[model samples]
Target: MIRFGPAGNGNSFYEAGHKSSLEIPEYLADVGLNAYEYQCGRGVNVKGEFCRQLAAKAREYKIFLSLHAPYFINLGTSDPKVMESSLRHIAKSLAAAKDMEATRIVVHPGSVGKNSRSEALARAERLLAQTAAELMPSFPGISLCLETMGKINQLGTLDEVIGLCKLDKCFMPTIDFGHLHARDLGAIKGRDEFEEVLDRIASSLGAEVVQNLHVHFSAIEFARGGEIRHRTFAEREYGPDFEPLAAIIARDRLTPVIISESAGAQTEDALAMKELVQRYQTGEGGRDV
Candidate 1:
């Protein structure tokens, strides 16, 4: 279906006279978008009944729903107390996802902290496996998406997330292209570069998952540390250009759910990417959305 949508209540969304997150799906459907990502990046603060009604509204509008879990979860922690806290945080997010009937819950796979990268990753792996074993039975329908972090010190690399996905049946890779690009110092450019990523995922996980990917796209500013911030579409010169990825998506006829993470213009940028894909598929050139 090649779904294109925004990360949260987009910049334009607030201007359109909306206050509640639950009001997003109908607006998205009205604008030809078929997907919605509700952000609980701080934490899941709502009641189960609230999420249930939100899920029902999304289903009524045929919008695919996904949730971004809390930002504080760091399963790579060396401290036993912090690890226990992380477990509780993730479990709470999973419970919310089950109540909301969300297809996926995006999570940052944790950081290296004071430990060596290898040690942190190994810790993360064990924690994730334990999490799956404990929670999968209760929340079987939702997938835990380990995100590709933009920072170098963080545990989430493309390979790291892919490895984590292999740790459990409940996990999947959340392919944050902006984070990948930033981590590689703005590496992605043309079709070959973009296809190399898709190929790696396909080779590792299988083609079906690759074809129906959950991808994030945005132009990012990066330093030696990686991922300074996400930029708007108006900053065209700064990019791992969407056109190349759009071309590949169209050519391969993949059914990816692409979420835009532009600082404020996420919905506008997502619509722009959807337009770019349409232009490529139709073989027309140079039209903006």
Candidate 2:
């Protein structure tokens, strides 16, 4: 199914009188959303039994669960010690995802740092290969998704991420449309632009990925450095609006799980997206612009 949910609880969630992560799935279902990305951006600090409990609840509500790997992982590092540590972080994140029965873990494809992009990516490729080789057989249900980087100096160009995906059949690309827009100075604004991205992805990966991708969407503020921050949907000037992307997905009949990463009100924004797409699919009109 085409799932939609938030990266984490936002201000509105607490404002709505919700207090626990355990309650997230039921709340999301009540609100008509069906996806959730557990934020382990800081660390996979939750206990295994706790993750299993969450997974069970998620299954009960039919909410698709995913995880964000810790932000500190840097397989691009040349320093042997740092590379080792980064691999450990990925391994731990994978283990945590397995415990939660989450299907995928989104990871930043490392950074440029002091090295050239090519050098960093080459090193990252080697390490990621090692990671998959060691981890995949044991955790066949889990996938490591390489995210498209927003910053000019970062290691996640669409091509770079696609290339990294080639390291293993298990790899998936976390195509963050907001990041793509920010990086290109708001390049995607309509169906054609969004279609070009889909076309490229389908060409590179295959029709299956085109139809069943994992995506992240939000409006964003940026500078020459790219991706300054995520913005709520209410922010008028900042965007790669959900409307065109929604239209394209509806027309293509894809089943991508879309996660919202708005600065605040992520659940609200995600619900808005889900509703808009639903309308488009059902041939209802006058909701999107």
Candidate 3:
């Protein structure tokens, strides 16, 4: 199925009088979503009991759980101290996912600081290879999902992510269409652009990978440096509209897990995408662009 969810509990979740993360699954199920990405952008400090309880609740509601690893992890770093810290962060993330019975952990590949893009990518590749060798065997069921980044100087371009994923079978690409659009200065104008992206990934990673891809989508504000912030679907000024993507997924029968990263309306935006997909499937959606 094409799963739709928010990257984390959005403002609506809290405003609705739901406080605990444990209630997320039921809330999502109630709103017609089937996935949830727990945020660990700061650190992976969730207790074992909490993880287990959340997992149980998710299972009860049939939610597909995922975790976003700490944003501080920088696999592209050349410094031994930073690299070691990054490795530790990922190991902790994997442990948390295992405890929660989450199948995937999304990661940012890190930025290209003073080094050239190629050098940064190479460093990231080596570090990730080490990660796969040392940590992956313990978490056999979980996939390390590398995300496409928004900044122009980041190490997560579409090609870079695909190349990194090629390093190990357990690696998957988290195709953030918003990031791609922002990084490319709002290049994704319509269905044709989205189709090209899907086709590129399928050609490089095989049809199976593309069919069941991990996706992050939201409208974004961008500048020359890329990705100012994620915007809600109601922000009609944003260029990367979800309707074209929904139509593409419907027409191709892709079963990606789409997570919304809208600033505060992530849950609402995710539901909107899900509704679009349903409409497209029933031939009631707007004309494909």
> Global lDDT of each model?
0.87, 0.88, 0.94
Ten contiguous residues with the weakest lDDT in model 1: 280-289
Local error of candidate 2 at residue 57 (angstroms) = 0.7
As a whole number from 0 to 100, the lDDT of residue 92 in candidate 3 is 92
Task: Order the candidates by lDDT, highest first.
Answer: 3, 2, 1
Best by TM-score: 3
lDDT of 3 by residue, 12-85 (tens): 99999999999999999998899999999999989989999999999999999999999999989888998999
Candidate order by TM-score, decreasing, is 3, 2, 1
Residue 34 shift from truth in candidate 1, angstroms: 1.2
Root-mean-square deviation (CA) per prediction = 2.0, 1.5, 0.8
Which ten contiguous residues of candidate 2 have the minimum total lDDT?
A: 280-289
Candidate 3 at 246: error in angstroms?
Answer: 0.8
Quote model 2's TM-score: 0.97
Residue-level lDDT of model 1, residues 172-220, one tens digit each, is 8899998999999988877777888899999998898889899999999
The collision pairs in model 2 are: none
Model 1 TM-score (2 dp): 0.97
TM-score of each: 0.97, 0.97, 0.99
Q: Candidate 2's residue-wise lDDT over 98-186, tens digit each?
A: 98899899999888999987899899999988988887778897889999878878888788888898778889999999999888877
Q: Candidate 3 has what TM-score?
A: 0.99
